[model samples]
Target chain A: MTALAEPIGRGGAERASLARRASGWLVLALVLVSLASLFVGATGLSPFAFLKAMLAGDAVDLRTKVVILDIRLPRLALGLLVGASLAVSGVVMQGLFRNPLADPGLVGVSAGAGLGAIVAIVLGGLLPPALAAAMGYALVPIAAFAGSWLSVIVLYALATRGGQTSVATMLLAGIALAALVGAVSGTLIYMADDAQLRTLTFWSMGSLGGATWGKVAAAAPLMLAGLIAAPFLARGLNALALGEPAARHMGVDVQVLKRVAVVTVAAAVGSAVAVSGGIGFLGIVVPHLLRLSIGPDHRYLLINSALLGAIILTLADMVARVVVAPAELPIGIVMAVIGGPFFLWILMRRRGLMMGL
Target chain B: MLTAETLTVRLGAHEILQAVDFTAHAGEVTAIVGPNGSGKTTLLRALTGDVAFTGAARIGALDVARAKPWELASRRGVLAQFTGVAFPFTVAEIVRLGQASGTAGAATDLTEQALARVGLAGFAPRRYHDLSGGEQQRVQLARVLAQVWEPLDESGPRWLVLDEPVASLDIAHQIEVMELARAFARAGGGVVAVMHDLNLTAMFADAVALMARGRVVTQGPVTAVFRDSTLSDAYGCKLRVNVAPPSSTFILPHAALT
Candidate 1:
């Protein structure tokens, strides 16, 4: 048995444990990146000074306190949650579709959420004032979450029949859905007043620029639900890598797995998009990079994706803040600028592997 | 034992499998052989509960349709005709998926042993997609083998339901795979394989179920079902079955002895 086992060649247990170890390093990177994010803003806030102020409790000035607590702290928290959400959603979507290229943004989930947000911004005044006040700041995120949830359910229905999902159909339908969403959003944009138009513009082009503790509190529950569901889904998703039937044969409930995966992706991506607009490529780019490194076993892939995604997106948000100084480029633009090339690099390097795609 | 009674499978407007009755006893290799559209694979699918069908299909006491997936999985492992991995997974990783249930007996780590059984020793770390068609098929076989490693346990005998288990392999590997199936059956497990090659089926299958257009033409032992006229009519072509010489180099009458 030992002789036979010797040639087994890196059993999954070892690789999974290796990924577990790798995640510790990723957590460390996330912490370092988060620290860098806190201090790498346009303002002259030094970490040493912040540490000193922390130790000497009453010495920090009001402006400095506001800069760290109200401004940077909320932004960092939102970035971490949103980044983790996007990356984890990407992992789930790709695993659900069994394709590395599948992303929430590509599948119209983000567009649907955008449509819901646009609807809220343009026609919010028409709502009964009391009800609108009741929903409070949560109205947009709720609407966005609903839109994304509906989008996934619709896409799933369109593509699945007899308990089987056709990846090709889901993707083509996603394109059509995105086009339809763009049309609807266009009409709403036309209806927007000047201030509403300004808000719409900022919302459509993604940003953490307006991050508040309230927004973080609103988004965290949905995103956290998705993140929590990911670990449970990891083994099933790994089984699903061998096609739906094979996974079922291996005792995975294929239909339940698909439903849970769809909901997880929708909730996470919807809430993130609701808070931060359309942060493209983070989903696709993060999971793909992690798979290339960690070998696509979702057990560790999902966790490492969360950690690495938080790190990368935090780093990108920091760059977005610092690149244009006090005037900020939307985090979406920064993501596209970096992620677009990285995605192409992946394509160029793995062109042979893309033959199936 | 595995049995399907009045099994019918419909796709869109057509009934792919029409009230097909079949049975395979424990500790025997039962082969399903037929023409291209004769529903051989569909029958296997129905038995495995991959497709919805009306009628009763049961492995042991568990109803295939009503039983939970894990319950069925613990009793049998299925080898699909074509299994594609969506992402890059090592051969070892693919085989380890079979161990996910942890029901294959006291020894949970059958990855290496399973690989060696399928002639895939030392091929574990190789990427599944990087392998040739035949190699991938064997890797999948290894995975299935790991899934139901022991032939019998406290519950009852396990089963291996395979669809076209060796459609792509060269003749040498084909023999290896068929022997693996035979050995599995000989170990008190049951194996129901959909076979394209009649000679291999004759050599390994303890019983044969012949079908024509979703209906069973005849089903019995190899000698009874592999008759010339029966096979010719079922396949819609002339097929002559000749008993090879006892000392023949390639074809042996080993199944006849069984």
Candidate 2:
């Protein structure tokens, strides 16, 4: 009889009504920010001017028109893709690892990707100009994805004991792998000439300067594929959040689900890293925020986190573009400047959640 | 029909359950009882093919060892003690997951009915993470119920496997769930539970199976197995046994050793 007070009144229409209202406000806020991105840049474009430019498909100045379409629009689109990928990846990592403090980058995945890109740059600089010119920017991102996937595979192999993945051992192994990759990165920096060092520094900090339509075009399809595949994974993920054995009992192929999530996260984060560089913590922050907003159902959580992540990244990138007008700061730096404080707040606010980390 | 033949399960160096053999008939509640680490949960998992076992389980001409995931899913609905809910799924949405064929037909309605059976009606639209532990279990129970809830002709052999189902429930809900399991068995479904409470097991179980060190020590009708000597042996200590006037059984662990 005790602890059964009022049956918790399953499906109170009134509570559902409130949740819907909150979601409405969140969506509305995102819309306003997206629209704001069109106008609130260094260019003296008004909301009406930006909207007209978007709809009318023309501008008085050809350069301005090109900037809106070629520069800002693709930048906005890439932001959305990267954001969605990181948020979804973060949520998946949390479930897959069964630790609230867990993030996709926990297993040295992003670090590996970053190191891969840095190495590509080092090797490319050594190559003859004709060969380098043929490859263009493609080699770096491709190398990054390959390295990231390899790191994930190694971590998975290391962390798995018998058939089960131990959450603690995985985390520890991730940390160790990250340190090793990080040391490699540091050595590269030490050996590089000023130009390579500069490139390495910017890439390591993360950036959206490389946000061309080409990169966005590449990222969009993979992001869409991940977003589509993510919601179907909710049932298995929700079951996993309890523990592996419990998930297995509920007819969830626990190991299969883990593999699916790991691969999905790898692909999603790998592509995001390929384009935007090593943007830390957006993956960690957005999923937690979504959990706070909606209850912990992956069906809603996955989609909402994607949207929120896109909206936040766009808004942050907008700030990055304007903060030092003419010489735009990299968006990754902007995110860190904002994200670091918020992360501290979260750990302080949710100590219990951080325990498993 | 469920039969466990000399099942021995080991975890690390600990022999949690050893050579356990028992059979549970359809349309009856079979309760497995013992102290902590006596391997009750392991036996249930072994039966469902969730864990590997040294022996085999035969259910209606099917072997547990070679059964496919879907094959096992169709024959048994299991509720592990700790069900994780890290995502934000509505209660109804969660219950609907038990739909193997992925349709919202009569079976879906039965899921809602099952939730109602566990006093979780109208909670369907609520977020799962916001609910208490007991509420989550009911939602899980509803999910299992929906998985097993089939139409008349397609109603194949199904067994309910619950590991500590009532551990997190309130006293009232505990009785409600016990009564539901009893009713399901009465309606031709099989029920196997790993439970700790001797009193509730006495009230609802048709037969009692005892496990120790990963093996079924003995199993029989409730009246025969739930004796002072059996209780003492089950816990590896001397234990007092009392039969209440209301036909309920009681047990206690005797004092410490040197």
Compare the candidates by TM-score and give the number of the best one: 1
- TM-scores of the candidates are 0.92, 0.83
TM-score of 1: 0.92
Please identify model 2 stretches exceeding 4 Å from their true place: A1-61, A128-130, A161-167, A337-357, B12-16, B58-63, B68-71, B84-116, B119-153, B167-175, B227-258
Worst 10 residues of 2 chain A by lDDT: A1-10
- Can you list the residue pairs that collide in candidate 1? none
Tens digit of per-residue lDDT, candidate 2, span A75-169:
77888788888888898888777656688888767878988998887766787889888879887887898889899899989989887766678
**CA error at residue B138 for candidate 2, angstroms:** 5.5
DockQ of the two-chain complex in candidate 1:
0.56
Candidate 2's docking class is acceptable
Report the C-alpha lDDT of model 1 over A1-357, residue by residue, as the tens digit.
011112212556666666777788888888898888888888978899889878988578888888888998999999998899999999988998888878877566887898889888888888999999999877777787778877878888998986777767888999999899899999989878999999888877788887888888888898899999988999899999998889999999888887788778888898899888878778888887766656788988899889878888898899899988988998888988987887788667666554333
lDDT of 2: 0.75
lDDT, model 1, position A322: 93
Native interface contacts kept by each candidate, as a fraction: 0.68, 0.37
